[model samples]
Target: AVALGVKFLDAQRKELPQGGAALADLVTLDMSGLDPRLGTVKIEVACDVQNLLCGPEGASAVYGPQKGANLEDISIMDSALNNFGEVLSRVANTNLLELVGGGAAGGLGAGLVGFLGAELRPGTQMILDITGADEKIKQADLVITGEGRTDFQTAYGKVPVGVAALAQKYSVPVLCISGDVEGSPDFLADLGVATCFSVAEGPTTLEEAFLKADEQLERAAWRILTVWKLAEECQLKKLRHS
Candidate 1:
């Protein structure tokens, strides 16, 4: 936005015209680039998410909490994004508001596609294809995937969920193990994740959590494997009886 002479006023609603980016009254944009558009340049932007530009699953509502933004902040910011999206669509002749992956990096995906005519592809899937992940997932009976954190945003195409989507095609189960879990991921079951687990044994301070992360993860993985083995043995016993 700086390059385009647009600026965001991230201030409280009560604070006024001095601090509102998404609120239409306090917003202004004039991004007619001095340079001509780069004609015939094929740009492929990789996104790890599939969030659209607006709505509940969009950027502000989904990611604002992680950045310390409260409900009020999210409401205001989302409104502002509406204004930005309007301008981008008009200027670029591209309808980016509801485009998939448009919410990546809080609408950076929309900006790139709107202004530069870029393509947004799932970053994880692109990497998987290049590394032949389909074959590996097809062969695995169960897939264990993880990330530093898992939350509602994970459904919008985080690594664990992305892997789960792939596993579903082959009827394989997926277990999501994370450092921590939050945000009511009830939909994960429908996405082929059998369950989600947290490595933390109990509550701890941030510093302590980071310090003991490796130790906790190792123990958690061991416990998970043990349970898996027990389940496998039980299945075998049932098979013998039948």
Candidate 2:
């Protein structure tokens, strides 16, 4: 499935402004001229399922602020998303302006669905399916997964939780090693994680942590693996005695 980025697509639209590229300029576009090949393939997108194409809770208004957008920028970005959505909708003969999750990734979700015959799914699910994670998990004795940081947010369709779900299907233990860890260990355990470890050994600035990331990660992995080996040996001894 082709997941198009709204900003990237808008910047590429034939319409251009004098100062720079602007999404609002594309409002006058002809939808009938959209790519014809888009109809032939099934497109799926990954994003937050609750956001709409345009408005207060929409992509631009909600996410744009964090991207360094001032009030003026928010208005322009919102207008651009609306323009893109409307044009794509007209060309594809499908209305997606208020479609759920349409605002994800700056309205890319809506644009692809409206213009490219795409559907939307959780990003984790999409990645797992694409990577054949289920098949891979079934063959492994233990699964190790990590990210820059892990927290309760991990349970909300994040990578580690997604991997844990697959590993759990085969009753395999899952271990998470990350740059930083938040929430309680029990929280991760409830999500099917056997345990979690952080590369950060003590309080340190982000710059220091980044510089030592490689060394810290290698040391953390070695320690976990060593401990796991001992645990396995103990289990084996118990089984033999029983």
Candidate 3:
């Protein structure tokens, strides 16, 4: 099967002089057997493949449908990816369809790994390393982070958890700001997130809440900063009198 796939690709490569380089940096073929539990891993692979392909748009067209893809669009994108994959196989002797992560983002992840030699790394670890979040926590007076929502999955490398882990290492106070604070607050307390603040003042429609998010965020930040400033001023005044 792999040999036949490779032979088919070689024939297609002759048509494109740049050798499908313009089509995609990588080609992913979506196969059906992917596990759902590996969704995050698959997403990371898809994003990487998108980078290897021309960019996010290429990846989105190829992989976006699995999340919620229409049949007609998926078919068109699939054909494009398959042709690109064939070209890669002919020139590089790499059968992208059989590769892991190849089926990511409709098999784009596999395509990148197979054709572009992209490596798969844990997404959280990559983010932590790149952001220097640990170092930031070590140096900051306080660390604040949050997400759109917090759930059991939050422990599985969500932004809040990642920030809290780093903050814990430094014994820094970590505060979470969320759209809604559901679940037990005590659950997060154990994780070293000192407090979680909900942005909502009262119940309202979804559209109304979204419209006010910017103002609410600013108000919250201002309130926090004002308290910090006032406390600092009082401390300075006391020191001067002493």
Best TM-score among the predictions, by candidate number = 1
lDDT, candidate 2, residue 3? 24
Report the C-alpha lDDT of model 3 over 187-232, residue by residue, as the tens digit: 7777787777777779888798899998877777667668768988
Candidate 1, 9-126: lDDT as tens digits: 3234231244335355433344454245454678898899998877898788887888899998889888877777876787778888978999889889987887778899888888
lDDT of each: 0.80, 0.75, 0.58
Clashes (candidate 1): 1
Candidate 3 versus truth, CA RMSD in Å, comes to 11.8
> Ten residues in a row with the worst lDDT in model 2?
1-10
Task: State the displacement of the C-alpha of residue 79, model 3, in Å, after optimal TM-score superposition.
Answer: 31
Please give each candidate's TM-score: 0.83, 0.64, 0.48
* Candidate achieving higher TM-score, 2 or 3: 2
Reference-based lDDT, residue 54, model 1: 73
lDDT at 25, model 3: 35
